[model samples]
Target chain A: MRRYLRIWRIFFTHSLIQDLEYRLNWWLNAFNTLLFLGSSALVLWVVFTQADAIGGWTFDQALTLLGVYLLIEGVTVVFLVPNLNRVPQYVRKGELDYLLLKPIAARFIVSTRYASVWWVPQLGLALAVILVGMARQGTLTAGHLGLLALMLVAAIGTLYAVWFALTTTAFWFVKVDNVSELFTAFFAAGRFPVSAYPGWVRALLTFVVPVAFLTTVPAEAAAGTLTWGWALAAVGVAALLLALSQALWRYALANYTSASS
Target chain B: MRWRPRASLGDVIRVDGLRKVYRVHEKEAGLRGSIRAFVDRRYRDVVAVDDVTFGVAPGEVVGFLGPNGAGKTTTLKVLSGLLHPSGGTVRVAGFEPRRREGAFLRGITLVMGQKQQLSWDLAAVDSFLVNQAVYEIPDAVYRERLGELTEMLSLDGLLRKQVRKLSLGERMKCELAAALLHRPDVLFLDEPTIGLDVTMQQQVRRFVADYNARHGATVVLTSHYMADVTALARRILVIDHGRLVFDGDLSALVEARAPEKRLRLSLSERVDRADLAALGRVHAAEGLEIELGVPRADVARVAAAALARLPVVDVAIEDVPVEDIVADLFAQGRAARAADAVRAAHEAGAAAGGRG
Candidate 1:
């Protein structure tokens, strides 16, 4: 585990250097990220101006959900999204062999090997939104804040596990070029609370796809509506999903007819 | 393919009847099958590796010689634990490759020419640092190996340059350094010198030879370039169409497959095609030059006859190239396969007739 962390640090530093190598690209990508967040914020502002609340949550409460959504999106785009996009190409081109031959766990190597540092700045914008939402809510107890932190960690783990499982489909499904696009389209639902969605869609996002664990539950914890039982359930689900994803990864590795082959 | 030697630390790697099958989706050209594939895909099994077996004794250098799609890469992937064999057994440095334990991984390294392991935008030295962490190389050893490899490969100044900015040869040198950071006992190199200029190729070949000599590392190299094999590998394992066709000394392969020497005659005037045919099989003919293959024992007689009868300005005799010999081997494999297909078809026809 110590060795793995060392590898992860190296990977992170390499990624940072790679981004810094091209100053123009670094600035342009950062601007691109802000433009995207600004557009999302504009959409939220326009919707809130029309109505004080969408479904049960007020505008401030909805912004809190958006903040959590940004946090999760930033995490995904920084690590999981880039890695998932790489897996299919590697599987197709057989580039994954190099990672497989390394002295570390293949999952850790593949998932965290390369970082997309461009998306990390979005976390700042997300924190700003979280602060504004907290100010509107007036106060937050220390216990609730602690629970919120735990929820955020569990949510990120669950989201990463879900992405891993989805990307592992490339091993069995060969032609997964469009898988990421489909996943992104569905994951966009996490920008709003599950309560705002219809029953069936909510159930699908909460249970089948688990986007609620990625955004809504964390936002709920921030809104002081989070229950300990559900938070435990989220942690349990994340652990189970991570275990299942690892099993799937091994199965995929066993069947991976390397591109060279 | 058999593994009677059993488990022993002396033998770093052992392979026993390893097989790999690829279930590739099959689709026809034209509009009909393309549309049908979208509705329902069809697949067929392709035997990429058909019972390949070889072992690397610790500190030995071996070469895998094969044309494209001959399963050399497949066999390497299986040995490195990148791909699971459809059947058979393999052990790499006392560990099952499929398990991919840290010990097994630390014991080996694979260098692929077509794909790069370095971070493209980062400096080559940074890539080495990353490798250091992954391989858990102590700083002292890492520095020593890095210095040695950098000097040997002439990579002193290039290490600080970004990988994308470096030349292909320089990048390959950095790649080699990164691979060797762990001092892996086993090295699998697939076309390590592909696309390099002749001088760079020689440089890499020298580095590999010296590395193997100094470290006593077992190396398995695969390359289309005969020069790479001739320069580095004493023993060559030739594969054709996913099967081990020949395994012996490089010289032995040439001697057995191509016993005859080629003689080229540059005449002042165009030689008659018939005359050349009468002397020896005409390998090639141009305006004023003719190349022929003659038995080694009869080379003197053939050269003497050609000189006396023809307006030969210059004559030279040289051994057949290794590429030509391997090509001939592939051609022969194809012919044999065609013959088997015909024989099988005849048997099937006869059975159908009997049933009718």
Candidate 2:
């Protein structure tokens, strides 16, 4: 485990240096991220002004949910999405040969080889938004904050596992570049509370794609309304999905015929 | 060079009846064909490697020689554990390559000419460090090996530059350094000298030779350039149509396929083509020079006769080139396949006659 962590450290440092080389790109990406956050916040503000609550949640609650969505998006774009998106290209171009020859796990090398540093500022922005919502609600407690942290970690794990399982399919189907786009589209629903949708849509979000675990559960924890049952279920679901993703990755690797065979 | 006895050496790589079949999708050209393909897709099985069997000693440098689509790369892939074989067994370093155990992966490295493992946006040294971490090399060992590889490959200033900023030769050298940082026992190189200039090709060839000599690594190289094979490999494996056609010493291959020598004569005066033809098969004749293909047993006699009977000013004798020998071998393989087809047809006809 320490060795894997060291490898990740080296990879992250390399990415940081590469990212620093293009100073203009860093500024542009940061500006774009801010613009996206601002637009989403504007939409939330406009909706909350028209009604006290759209789905039995107040303005502060909705703001906290939006913050959760941005935080998860920040993590995905920074670490998981860029690397996972390259899996199909590697398979198609036969570049995976290099990865396969490494002494480490091929899946670990491919998934964590790149981490985009430019998107990290969005994560900071997400923390600011979440804090602002908590300040507005005047509900600051040590126990609630601790629970929110645990729930946030579980949420991120669930998201990572889901994304990983989807991208691992690229080993078998080389043309699945659009799979991540499907994830993004489904994840957009997390911008609102799962309760806002109908009963069936809520169940789909909770079980099928599990976007509710990513946003609603964590947001509820921050709002001090998360039940013990939901928190335990979220942790259990995250563990199960993580194991499932690992098995799926192994199966996909075994099915890899390699290009130019 | 003379052929040496290889039976005394212990084989580190043993492959038996290895086969790899690929399922490739087939689609036609026209709109109708496209629609038909969409409605009813067809996939054909391509036998990339067929019942090929060979073995390599612990320190042997073997050249895999073949034309395009002759399955040289496929064989290397199977041996390196990149592609699983459809049938048969392969053992490298006393482990099944397909299993890809950590010990197996650590003991071998595969370098493809067209593919790169360096981080393109970072300095080559950074990529080397990444490899150091991946292979879990100790800091002291990593520094020592990096120093050795850098000096051997003349990669002092190039390691600090971004990989994208380096020239092709420079990048190739760095690629070699990165691949060898761990000092793997077995090296699988596929067209490692492709697209390089003559000088660069020679540099890479010399590097491979020195590295192999210094480390005693088992090297299996696939290349179209005969110079690469001739300079480095003494034993050559010739593959054609997914089959191993020839596997033996380089000199033995030349002797079996082309039992002749080339004699070039610079005459004092122009001679008749018929007079030159009487001595040997005239390959080419210019104003005052003639090239002859003489059998190996009669080369000395022919040279003496030409000097005594003709106004020869200069004469040179040389063995047949490896390129010509390989081309002839490929041609012979084609002919043998054709003959086998005809014989099979005749047998079938006879069987049909008996049935009637």
Best by lDDT: 2
Q: Which stretches of candidate 2 lie over 4 Å from their true place?
A: A258-260, B1-9, B267-270, B286-288, B311-313, B349-356
* Candidate 1 chain B weakest lDDT stretch, 10 residues: B1-10
**lDDT computed for candidate 2:** 0.90
Clashing residue pairs for model 1: none
Which digits, one per residue and each the tens of the lDDT, describe model 1 over residues A115-219? Answer: 888767788788778767867885466876788788889998887887788888988776777877887888899999888999999999989988989888988
Query: Per-residue lDDT for B1-356 in model 1, tens only?
Result: 22223334567778778888887777889899899887899988899889877777888788888889999888888888877778988888788887788888888899999989887778888878878887778899898888888888888789888799989988898898888888888999999999999999999999999999998999999999989988999878889889988877778888888889999999998767999998898998988878999999999999999999999999999999999998899899999999999999999999999999
For candidate 2, list the clashing residue pairs, or say none. none
TM-score between model 1 and native? 0.88
Model 1 clash number: 0
Q: On a 0 to 100 scale, what is the lDDT of residue A114 in model 2?
A: 94
lDDT string for model 2 (B1-356, tens) is: 34334233268998888999998888999999899988998999999889988889999999999999999999999899888999988889889998889999999999889899988888999999889988999999999999999888999999999999999989999999999999999999999999999999999999999999999999999999999998999999889999988888988888877788999999898777889999999987888978899999999999999999999999999988889888988898999999999999999999999999
Report the number of the highest-TM-score candidate: 2
